[model samples]
Target: MRRDQRTGDHRHSLPAQAPGPGNLPLELTAFVGRTAELAALTAALETGRLVTVTGVGGVGKSRLAVRAAAAAAARGGAWLVELSAVRDPDLVEHAVADALRLTDHTHRTPRKVLVDHLAGREVLLVLDGFEHLVEACASLAGDLLHRCPGLRVLAAGRRPLDTGGERIFPLAPLPAPDAAALFADRAAAGLAGFVLDEGNEADVAELCRRLDGIPLAIELAAGRLRALSPAQLLSRLDDRFALLTGTRRDVPPRHQTLRTAIGWSHELCTAEERLLWARLSVFCGPFDLDAVEYICTGDGLRADDVLDVLSELLAQSVVTREEGPTGVRYRMLDTVRAYGADWLEATGDAARMRRRHRDWYMGLATWCELDWFSPRQARVAELVDVELPNLRGALEYCLTEPDETHLGQYLAGSLWFYWVGCGRLAEGRHWLDRALELDGDHDDSRLKALWVLGYVAVLQGDTAAALAALQECKDEAERTGSAIATAYAVHRTGCLALLTDDVERAETLLRSALDQYHELGELNSNVLMGQVELAMALAFRGEIADAVVLCEDVRQVCEDHGERWTLAYALYVLGFAAWTRGEPATARELVMRCLALDHAFHDLLGTVLAIELLALFTAVEGDPAEAAVLQGAASRIWPSVGLPLFGSGNFGRPHALCEARAREQLGDARYEDCLAVGARLTPDAAVSRALRASSGGKAKTRRLPLHEGRAGDGLKQGELRPGQRA
Candidate 1:
């Protein structure tokens, strides 16, 4: 489905999207002067299974690919995976998975997720900014093209992926007319009353020609309109272009042109602007003013002058203003940021700026974690989602530097809310696993990371990993005398017990953990979640009344603090209790609320549980056919999440009962047919159908038609829902 390109946070709303219909950002500015290129690309992709638009930096490859994919993939849709910010080769698959928005709860490799999701869909996979990950991309694309018959790979980068059967479309500089038109358009935006009129058309053409017709170059040169006219700009550029290239054999001529253009723009910037530009290169993704102020200030760039200097950069087109869910932010194009990075390195300030960047994001993560415990929980999710790239950069910095392992552990441990609550379990595992491999100086930080890893593993149904991590954390915490670490270790061990269906042990351990938390005066999402888990254990042990009472208390606290993550779990337990007591109406309302919160937070496990529960409700409502379909939808999602019903008798009973009833109402063949219908719906479509089915649209009416494909972007994958455990 189409999302507003302006609100970038909307793109980050889900954990990444499950493969669905197309999602291409609506171009903010008009796509100009690529008519032939667009036509050629469209034709290439139409006939070729793997087409790469290769060009030097700033030659409009990405832009042209986006335009072509949008047009060519009209039937199945296109999914854009941006790899510029992702540095690790191993994460190339994860980056693609995130782009496709696969919400798998299991520890399955990202390659498996992509192959499984793409095998059936006729979708164009657009991999932009992937030059840095060429080998990985080549491997992945080769595998996908071999397995997914309907899939097409459209990649944009500086070089070819060099895979078997790959088609390389080397992009050249725009012709004179198109380049001049691009300048006229960007120049008009930068300077008032600027147009391609008889007065300056020739000069504009000459300027674009000299700039080598590179889009980024043209845009940057156009920014000079505030200080110089087209004629004046041409006069100044003649001198600059004379020595722009001809001797650099290592770099392509187009690359040289791009570099020369950027260097000229750099030369044009004021000293403050140039310094700020170099400093700003430290950011991996779009950054807000608050972050820039915190990390980019100082270092000869006065704090108070950051705003003015940044404004000058923005005005000069060095930094472009972009909006996200959090409001206005700024971004530097990849090529420009690269140039700034080179400048930063030349100034010998690269390491310091990188450290500052890491520190700011670390601070941001800490604050967001705290905010996660308050009513600003949803807002925190938004901010984290928007800053994930930068946060990932921070985590990499800490983990890569030998002396910073402790900080890496702390950072990973601190983001438990984002990892578990926001449904980033797999990616969280990637970072935590990496952080934990090295020994940190601070045992407490490592212990915290250990417990969080255990908690995530429990959710992913990785019993061995969960048990090992938790046990080690307990042993280390006890040895180090860290009560907080011990408390979390115990708490997550209880979670592992619950997932594995050891309800009695779960109840005992969870109660102990909660006590430890209370004694330590620890009241946060984790403590409340421990309470909720205890209630689940109680519910599993047939103590429905006690479970209800405990969850009710947890709910009250969560509401008081505006906490939704723990609140969702509490609601799940309470809703199940309500259904047990035969209050179907109230049960539906409460569970629906839980589902809404879970989906909003991109909690795959929570969303799946709600869907499963609603399907059971529908079965009892005399619409066995509709109920069976919902069950099929849940079944489709369970693989991504891990084992269905968590292999727990308590959780499985409801699903079993619903299936039996549906079979009785509709014969085996009819019921199986309904299941197939539901299974065919994309993950997001199924959730949408489930939510709609749970609403006034009753089982009998079944007004909403379950379809085979996705309508738009949605949460389609699954993991263990909060109340889904035994």
Candidate 2:
């Protein structure tokens, strides 16, 4: 439900220009037989800006809306957001933002970013399969329509959103003729050489009628033709409907009919396949073969047997397959998943399956964290990207279950890199805060969560919260004798000090943390980054030689370890030191590399700092015009990162020097013009410009190696300067 919980990793699709490249899913099969409904829905859209296509489960509302939206795409740029997988009402905005391919670097609420982006655009937004999120959808649609005069919404759900200006276009089941035609089409696909004629017309029509003309039900019934004859299927349908006597009386007949159809399909599946279906329902979104194997196996079904049964489920249309850039993943329709979940509960294996689901994703997070500091960093990020929804589901189960709070804390704390490196600081804080609030003793997991919370709060410029969390983390670490937790506590405390310009204390804490890391053999990205922070602190204290040497050591270790996130920070300090040492070209090279890496991970803070440094280097290299432009670019990104210039001391000096020199050289009016140009650059374009030399100058070809040596050797923990408290 939250943006992070969506099925696919939402890399921005290219913006639609004139609707030539909208993201409507390509219809796999012929959009069988909904001529009248499609026409009516399209007509309704033309008159009403907000149209709700309401129907029961398996009634084809989603298909009808998409068909209408595709037709309107040419004129209004139609986009579809599939909301059945969304479970959290609060994540509705993120769902829409993902579907629109909106990736923002700002800390603004996703809703605000969405509204501001769509304010002037004329587009048709399709909210499909949104019954569970109706209220959230209604609120979002109302706000968007009120803000963007040209925006239109076409929502498909079991009921209406009922927002102002909304018109309910109730969709009935397919007419008999249409339903029969759909049955024959799918039957032909499932059973080769099968033709509907005098041989079976009556039986097909009777089967469709029994299924209540529901498109999904009809399709399921037809798919049985692969083995069962039409006469056999019709007989089976009659018995299935008759067995629905105990169904809810408050529900409509069509609802009962759909459930009976799904039940019949379930009954037809082999026992192993049925078990797999029930287990697969554990996933809230698409899942890969490996996940199915890991979570859906046991209790007489071996892990390797999953693929065979899974393929059978696919053949029977119990599960849907989608192929994306990552590869093939399977999903169940909400209706089918609901049926499976019911059976799963009935079987009394739901709790066991949920725990398996949680364990699998927790292992995945652990693997990703391990790989994050290796050459597999980018691929690891992509894999983690695809698993976010499952991760969210796991975390949800952990936090809500009385016995699983500690697991939730561990899971949230373990994903610090994914949250911080991937532009999800606010969400990270949300999970960490909730995890910490649960009733539990201060353990290692709580210690980890506390420090991660501190790190996130510091990045958000919430100094009070940051200090509070870190103090608790430090206290818990000492109490529990957790060396790793103590190291993280000391490292993040140093990070906070560095951000506040307490350079002396920062260096002392960082050195203590580094010594602890060495003792603990902590060689992940965090420890490497602790070294980077130490380098920055040393630089701020005017120990340029030692700072450069330390960063060089970090860069070598990162390169050797195949890490980029920590390496980027090392490059930043090394670049700044290079600039101060009168090596303009070396500074540019180092800073540009830093900018590229930061952009790759979407690290706003790193990206902004690098931009500001490049601007200062450019000013001294004599292109005052370009310096002003880069400064403007950095300014636009500062609010997104909070407390832009690190702290107002040596870390702030380069920005000040660049701004004064650019203003003196370019004068006021032209400087403003250049600044405007820089501010206009998108996040991607800003990185591109930083990589490209300004004023047509050739970028420096030769690279200068940063100092490579042991990190501040022979300096014991007790050797800290007087009054320097870590």
Candidate 3:
């Protein structure tokens, strides 16, 4: 929400001011020292168009403008329209209408009604705190500025309203001397016995400077004088920054603390506004109006009224509006949101609000899971990008609450799309572990979670964990007679077996899973996983033609379903098959395509696998330096998932071949170092053997010949080699 200070015509409705002597609103009280600011505001108002006062929070922009507007009241009736109360950008015009007391029910559009009411009104409209409603404010301000020749708009906000012909008066902090004087004045007013002396002047000056010369912060610090002497307060300031707002017994309690300063604006809210603010605290990031209406306002509150309540909150400074890439969004300051969260907890509705939050995220994730396999995969990825933080919050909430443990498992299971397709394998594994630890009786939910855990584990090269989890899930799914679960478990088990070079068992399990997927008409990424495993098994059996065909089929299905992650895996298989068949150029092209897509999606595992394969391609081309660089890159990305060279057993042999060539080029010392590094990574017997064998010039190839068995043979000689092509 960076501020664009070029436009300033848009204005928010101001807070109501009490009428005072000479029929003017309460003249800015004890307005300590803003002579230059007042002069600038006055100069902007003289043109009678639109003048916006902009500054950071607590800078006295609102207070100074109130005085300036009161002074201008002699020339025209100055009406203060506070927009901090308005939360919905769509209701900006309605807030103005309310501020003006325009009783026109006939006009449906608030903008039109406002225009009709103030078409010729000769009055100065003081719009205060309009940073949130820039767009709507701009439109309304433009309309009013065009229609009302005698109307003048004075705005005060954190940032300028970027409307055409809008003059902006940037309000800086009060000067040091003036800020010190004002602090002393406010302190003396609160504490009759207070006195400013040379002993504490330097500390007090530093305090004012640290407070950024912001009037509210100074006033808040000055209020602390009620309890402690200036010297004592200065000494304790470092420990309790919030204690700067000293208690004022006589002033309205709402003005007692900096929290209260913001809360006063909150207390002025209508009941609906207050409730909405409390509910909105659940969100961690900016949310759109539709999300607000869906998640916050409902049941007891009218959905349509959400707009009004949002407007009220915005005007009261409880919520700030922001313009996002999609549209206008609203958010609360972290401090303000923390305060609202406290209120939410006090209301005994925390559980319900959390439920609503979880439900919204659950529904969103479920939709993405289904949509990820469609032509809208790219669009679904974008949607997931926006909702990711909220989804994480929901997952966290579900995992923490005892009663919500099952829900957490369900959420993790449902987000298989995000985990597998988006390359969130590491995060998926982390949450899956937490969900399983809950020990809930959600066997079905646990089954899905287990499968996902196994999926991530397999990708990370944790064969034991992958096998244990998938086998457990398979047993449970079969016991429960859950066909879909069984199919998924079987498919993933095949993947694990393939990673371990058990091509015969891998092919058997994959074929079984494929049969079940076809029987159940489940043609999603789960089914794609089965086909990929089958292709890998075929490649391992040396049936390169069959492997190539299966890879092609999977790629087409992935394209048709818009499953880029699965497509990336299919490309890896296709490229490897081509590389083994001596088509280095084709292998390079396919591997590069997979690399490009994986990088775009931030799929760490996919990126590593693609890089490793590219390194093999470079080795095949006799370019060991380039091959080593790609291998190094893969090694760097490998540890992130803690499963170095996890799921690509078929590719591992080729990678080992490439590393040998690279070592030969770099000399025995560097090659031995690389092998030493690889040996210390993890206890994979195959990798250990590969490293040992490659160290010697006459390396013993442990590859089991696939031609020793039939087309659908199982594991033989503890290794699976490329079988004879059909």
Candidate 2 accuracy as TM-score: 0.85
lDDT of 2 by residue, 1-726 (tens): 111121121112222232454578766666665666777888888888899998898998887787788777634478889888777787778778768765443446778878876787788999998888888888999999999888989998999997899999998998777777778777888888987788898998889888889999999998888879999998887777778634688888888889889999988899998899888889988899998888888897998788899999999999988877678898888899999999999999999999999999999998887788899888777777777778888988989998788889999998998878877676677688889999655497788889999988888788888889999988878887888888888899899898888888988999999999899877888888888888888776667799888889988988898899889999998887776665657777888898889988878888888888887666655567877888888877776666667455556666766677677777889999999998877567676777675324443322322221124222222222222322
What lDDT is reached at residue 38 by model 3? 71
Clashes of each: 10, 0, 26
Q: Candidate 3, after superposition: displacement of residue 96 in Å? A: 44
> Which stretches in model 3 have alpha-carbon errors above 4 Å?
1-256, 311-317, 321-329, 346-348, 400-402, 647-649, 665-726
Of 1 and 3, the candidate ahead on lDDT is 1
Candidates, ranked, TM-score:
1, 2, 3
- Which digits, one per residue and each the tens of the lDDT, describe model 3 over residues 1-726? 121132211212333453431222553236666766677678778864888888767678778888788766633377777666445465466557546543221213456656655565567887877877887787788888898787788888877878888888888777887777777767777678655577777877887766667777576567556556666655555445455345556653223434544454454457787788788888866677877778886656788888988876665446767664455778876556766788889988877887888888888888888887777777677667566657877888888877888888989988877766665554566678788888877788889898888887776666777888888998999899999888888888887777666778989999999999899998886788678779878877778788888889988888766678778888988887766555556766787787777766666666667767665555444445545655655564464544466444555665666676677676777765654454333212222222233332223332223233223222222221354311
Identify the candidate with maximal TM-score: 1
Superposed model 2: Cα runs more than 4 Å off: 1-23, 33-49, 70-80, 97-125, 144-151, 188-202, 615-636, 646-670, 677-680, 692-726
**Which window of ten consecutive residues has the lowest lDDT sum in model 3?**
1-10
Per residue, candidate 1 scores C-alpha lDDT tens digits across 1-726 of 222232111111212322337777777676776666778989998899999998878989888888787777745678999999989898899888888888777888888888888888888999999988989999999999999999999999988999998999999888876677678767888788886777887888888887788888899889999999989888877777756666679877777887778888888888889999998999999998888888877768888998999999988888999887899999999889988999999999899889999899888988998888998999899999899999999999999986999999999999999999877888899999999999888987899899999988999899999999999999989998999999999999988888778888988899999999999999998999888898888877767899899999999999899898888889988988877766677888898899888888888898888888888777766577888899899888888888898888777867876787678778899999999998997777887887787876544633221221133311111111333532
Global lDDT of model 2: 0.80
Please report how far candidate 1 places residue 168 from its true position, in Å: 1.0
